[model samples]
Target: MENYNVDTVLKDIFDSKDSNNWKPSDKIPLVTKEIETLKNDLKTFLKSSDYNMDAILKESQELCDETNLLVSGMEMCKQEIEEETMAEILHSIENHDRLTKELESVNFALNIVYDVVQCGKYVKEFDDGREAQSFTRAVEAVYDLLQYIEMPAEGFKQLDMYNNTRHTAQLILDSLLSDLYGEWDRLISTSVKPGNKKTTITITLNIEDSLIVIDVLNALEKSKKLVEKVMEFSQFLLKDVLVPIINNDCIVFAETDELMTITVNQKPDFKPAYDAVIANLRLLFHYLSNKLNVEYYRDNSIMKMMGKQICAEFSDILVKDCLIDTIPNNINELQSYGQITSEIEDFQHFLVIVKFFPDDKISILKYVNNIDILFASKSSQYFLETARTIMLKDLSVTMSIGVETIPEGNPGTSADVSGTEEEALKILNKTMPRSLFYFPRCMISKTAQELLDLVYVMMEQAVQCSDVVCKKLYNTTRLVFELYDAVVPYHHENYLQTIPQYVALFHNNCMYLAHNLQTFGDKWLILMEGRELDYPISFVDLVQKLRDLGYRHLAIHMQQQRKQILDNIRSSDLNCIVVKDVLSDNAEAAVRQCLRQLHLLKNVWIGVFPINVFTRLMATLVNMFVDELIHRVCTVEDISMEMATQLTDMYTLVVQKAPLLFQNTTDVEQYVKSWKKLQELIFVLGGSLKDIEKHWKDGTGPLAVHFNTEELRSLIKALFQNTQFRANLLSKIK
Candidate 1:
């Protein structure tokens, strides 16, 4: 049966044709063959097997019956057991639920008891630590109590014992903080306050005591108050001690072995005062560190607290109030302050040693470092005052006038003239005008020198300041010179008018100031060029103004001199010489008087102005006299032989004496513009008509060059006969 192929044979019969094409003949053989094969396989299976079919069926029916009977019996037994135990099971479940509730209640009560007992134990430890003065231990116990009370057993917070325990811990913590702060305040007061002690401040606490306080405050996270308390103490010291010492009140500073009371005296010295301040601070730090044991607590130590407060006091109180007033006003006084800056630097180093100040936090030191600028601001007034004194010393301040040497290869002075005798004379004459002149150098009055010295000192100080402050100081320096320009002209106007020497000195001073200031601003700018400047630095405008001022003074004085010279000529009555038979002594006396005035001016202006300017001025005055003399002579309508001779002699006297005005440096004609014209007029006045014609040379000679045709015609009509020859000569003069 297991090896039978019945399905394969049947499928072969069916699949031999399509279903629609099925026929008995096509399928009968395949079906019959499969049927025969099935029959054979069945017979073989039956013959080879050894089994009893009836017996096997009987055994299966017996097992099925037994299974049904067992199931019925089990169901009946389960129903009986359920009916008997149902009420007892429900009762036991109720009992178990009630007992569990009772057990939970008991455990909750035990937890409450444990939490309250633990809180009470910690409170007792906190109280014990407090009684023993062990603040760290007390704060630690309170810390534990606070931790436990944060989340106690459920419903434990509503209990009276729980809240009472937490409240007790809180009270202890507050008390500890208050006591610790009190101890800190005491430490500060004792360390900083001098009280009535004349010398060393006594420290009542040991190092262990100070450390105990520091540890307690830090444990409670309240060290920030330390800095606040220190600043308050610093203010107290500033008001009571520092203020008196700086203000030069009855309280003064004196050195002692330790913290000492300020000595009572009227005298105040900044050095000793500052030294006393530093000494007190040193003793304070020394006592606090050595005796109080605060050095061990580096973060919140007393030294650090006081160091920060002292740094602020240095800028706000010491620098602003006390040290600022100590700044010197003058250069001599400034010597006293040389070590003050160093002392401040030493104070900075001391701060560094104490490790209280950080390198990045130097704002207070910056204020102290600006001491130079402070000095400049204060001393600028001194600079101005000194300059004022020098300028106002006297109207007639003098210095021995010395000739400054001319550099080689520079333009020649009158002394350098060299040519033919006449050519050299002409060259010397050309050098006389002040308009085209050279000065080797001009001398300054003693007042001017003193002012310049002050200026140099001020500019040097200005260069040492910051750019903004330096500019201010330099502007102050400009004001100094401006003061001179203003003060001299105003205060000494009378002296300038009456005294030639004073006028000369004022002019030279003005020139000297102008000369130095020309490059003054630029020179300092170069020295101070490390910073960028916003505007140009130059005194070009000021130099021009000073020059104008000098010229104005000199011109005003020259006006008076001109009037005197012209008035002397008028007094001579030179018109009488043209018509009088005898020459008047008044003419000679007038020349002498004019020479006296010229000599006086020459004496004052000789060393003051350059040689050329002095000579030019003198020649200009002489030329004015010549102009007046000629005008007087021309006014005469006719002249006798004696009159012409007298006029000629007067001309000779002037020509011979006028050269003295130049100090013999040049000839008179060289500087005097109309000198030759005067000579030609004199020649024509004294000569005959033939001689005059020869001198005139038909309008091209000296006479024609000196006088116009009309002037020559007038002269000929007055001194010679109005004949056909004279008329012809005057016509020919053109």
Candidate 2:
């Protein structure tokens, strides 16, 4: 520049360093003028032209070198900064991981504390006493420790404690509810007094184990203040769970009492420990029912209870009435009677009272006056009548009326003979009306005639005997007649109307007679027959004769009747044939009636037959022809000697043809004796059959020759030898 100073040159180079890529150096300005001049020259040169070419060149070279150095330095600095930034990021990441691990540890500890608290609460609800207390204490300690540790992290500490406590409390409350419900159910299931009616309780828990666990976990997770939260949950449950259970149980108990007075008189001493148990059980059931919303009333327990109550009541009543005891006694007595009895005299007396006061008028009146007195007075009547009705029917009674003459202390007016007679008539008339009335004529009207005839014959026979036996017979006959007087007149008034009643009375009398016979032996029959001295012989003869004659006559009559009816149907006019057909159509019924009557007579005879005779003649007759005899005879009057002969012959032939039929060695001797007797019967029946056959063959008999001829021949052959003929005769007879 004008003799450029080295210092200036250096200064210029240094100052320009800022403008170019040159390193700037710290230097002081020399003088004000020089600094001004240098600044002006620098401005002029910068504005006008490129200055300091050689110097600029040298400076540029140096600047280029410096630029290179500066760029290298900047790149190094950038590299260092990038390395530092990466290191800081890595450090922050490490710190975050450490904090995360610590938080996780805290959460894990809180969870453990919450679980312990929940377990404790559950134990408390279970009310396991010492076990529950220990568990609760352990839980509380765990919760306290967890709270202390979590205190520093304000948000986490509060939230964790609350969640743990709340969760534990909820578990305790739920357990309490379940326990209360269970207790209620047990109480209701127990039986109580007043008929010992049992009550049933049902409960349903809807919450599953998994669901309970899940809810408990959720509550614990959300809870913050452990202790307060636990207590709050417990209080909530006590109010929501226990109170409802208790209230519901009480209501159910109260309602049951109002609905039915468990009349436990039958189970007088029955008492259960808990009266409220049933109610509680019912409450539990109600709760379950409501929660489930289903019908469960017909539960097995309920049905069982109902059934037990019904059975117990039935047993008590059945025992108290002594019905079971009376049934066997009545049946045994009936069997002994050997005949059905309708009119038991004692029973008749009871029936008379019952019928007249069927509405219990008299009895009720008496009861109203004094129940105990009525029951005591009439207890016998009730039991006896009940038993008699069970054994008989159509009962009636007659009470003897007596008049007592009384002397008046003084006559108020004239002599009162007419008044006294009228009064007596009124009393008799009023006391005995349609139900309890007695008219002498009406009483003796029907049965009196038959009874009197029998009595007359009996009296005559008794008189003829004229011995001690005869005297006994006479006394018995007199007594029978006296009994007739007592019963006949009252019974005969409505003979057809009261036939059933009469039959019952007859049965009772037969029973009485049978009892007497059993006590006194065949003396009664002998007395009736009037052969007091030779009673045994006479009785046997009479019985045998009756059997023979009765059987024979009945068989013949039946055969004749059947043939007559068939003949009528075949040979009669159309109208007559129609009528006969109608009659024949009902023949089965008629036959059955005949058979029943015969069976009755047979039963009576068999019952009274001597054991010896039964083993001999009667047994044989019964075996061979009892069925035929029953079918043919409607009454004892139909029996005849001819029938007995036929039966005897038939039995003899059968025994001869098939000896095995008489296999019983004990009875074989009897059969032989019976067979001998049958030989005589054969002769008698053969004669009758021959006579009937001859009459029909001569065409002098209404019996068709073809019919009677075949029947007679068959009967003879069957009695004699042929199986075909016997079978044919059996068919006809049967």
Candidate 3:
């Protein structure tokens, strides 16, 4: 409000020397009033007017200039202070270097302590368990040193200041950790000892050594027992537990009406024992998770694999026990199957047992497959044994047999019966009744479905299994499959060497097999439908798997039998014409034998022998019969007309036997070819050439009327077997 001269008042205040001594504090009232005025002016300018920088700069220029001069002066003072502080810091650094050298001298004195850590670097060479022993001294050395890192911040500060000490300490710790890791690697290597035949004694000497090695693994003070826990679980579970239980020689069984049960008490302490190991391992895993930078799953895999192997062994033992108890009883009951034929007392029992097999099989498979899966995942032998058990249950005869003799027991009062054939009577009487039991001549005991099931178990268990297991499975399946042929000889050396019995048994057993296979295939398909049994494609279907299982010959044999049955199975036409006994019959009896031989030749014979071979076989038998008949008739002491007439009747009957033997045109054609061979002999057997012609031309003799001299001669030359007989007959023809 005081309007003094504006420019001159401020210029005087700026230029006056007195202003230097004048404290701004003393002029606070004037400065406060001036600020009040400027603040009011700014408010007015913001409300109404455009900004004018020249006017604003003119007002604050003095204050701004003063602020810049003060800042420059303060900056110069700060630089001078900083220069002196830097010189002092350099002196402190020089002092720190001198102290570090002194500390280095102290560290030189502690070389004895560093020597323990240096022991790890020297332990590069590891001997048997001794290499790990060298690590023990190193571990003990660094055990105290590792705690240095774990010390409080202020405590660790002492080491942090001395770089050489910290570096040397770190190197010692690294060396100890490396040696400890090497020891762990050793433990892991010793955990499994495969290739031992007795897997029950699973621990190798390396594993035993692992015990001592692990005890010495007292490194990394925090995780000292971590190595032992891992090794103990991995090695001991299989060796100390699984092996003892599997290799336990104890056999325990309890029988019931329905089935034989393996005592649960016999199963080893596998789960409880494993669970305990798992509990310790879980803690070990937790501890190792912190100390080591490793995958949780990978670090524990060695133990897990061992655990699975234990499970495999446990399942196998349970299964083996189940089979050992049940199979013997099953076979004992199976032996009673012969009772269905001969012993009728247990007829209902036999029926029930046979009928229950499917259910029994399912039950057996339920456990076996579970066991098989355990091993299929880990071990090969579990699979091999499971596949092997199905047949091992009844390792006796391939055929089913009835008890024929009572050994050293009660009898039907007679010591020996007159006229009873020695062979037949021997079966009737016995010192040991069961021992005399042999397969009934042509009767088959095992159902085809049962045999097929055996094949499935043998092969399916081998699926996804190891190479060694697959080989054993293949060889065993082949061996068991051969039992079918032995029990019921489709083909055997005895059958081949003995032709007459071969023909009879071949037809009977062939039909037995054909009918049974058809039933088996139907049931097997039904059983398998909608069921996804884990099998290789070759084994998925029973029919195909049998072929792949080396039972290809048997499978093909069944197929041929099926074809022959479809062709026709004439059980009534079964020929009992014994070729060996034919020569013993009288002329008329021999004629009847010839007719019987012809009847057999005509009927369709289904067997291991194909139709072509069957036809040839029949032709040979018929030729032999006719040969015996001719020899018997011609060699008679009296060559009278009556005898000649009797020969005509025999020849006629032989020819009559051929009329309806064949059902088809092709078969008839084949029969006629064979018939022509017989006709040659018939001409010679009828009489001399003149009488033969009478018999041939005459309407009376059926064969003679049909076959003339040239035809008969051609038949003998073409198909007749005996050359001397052919010559003798042909000479008579001339």
Highest lDDT, which number? 1
Error of 2 at 141 (Å): 5.7
- Candidates 1 and 2 compared by TM-score, better number: 1
lDDT of 2: 0.38
Candidate 3's displacement at residue 286, Å, is: 25
lDDT of 1 by residue, 192-244 (tens): 33334232222343234455656654654432344565566556555654554
Could you give me the TM-score of model 1 versus the true structure?
0.49
| TM-score for each predicted model, relative to the true structure | 0.49, 0.19, 0.30
User: Global lDDT of each model?
Assistant: 0.69, 0.38, 0.43
Candidate 2 residue lDDT tens string, 389-466: 322323344221211232323223335558887677666655644321111111112222333344445444444433
> Which residue pairs in model 3 clash with each other?
405-433, 407-431, 696-704
lDDT of 3 by residue, 290-406 (tens): 222222223432333333334444334534542322221112343443333232223223322333112222232233234333333323343334434432332212343222333
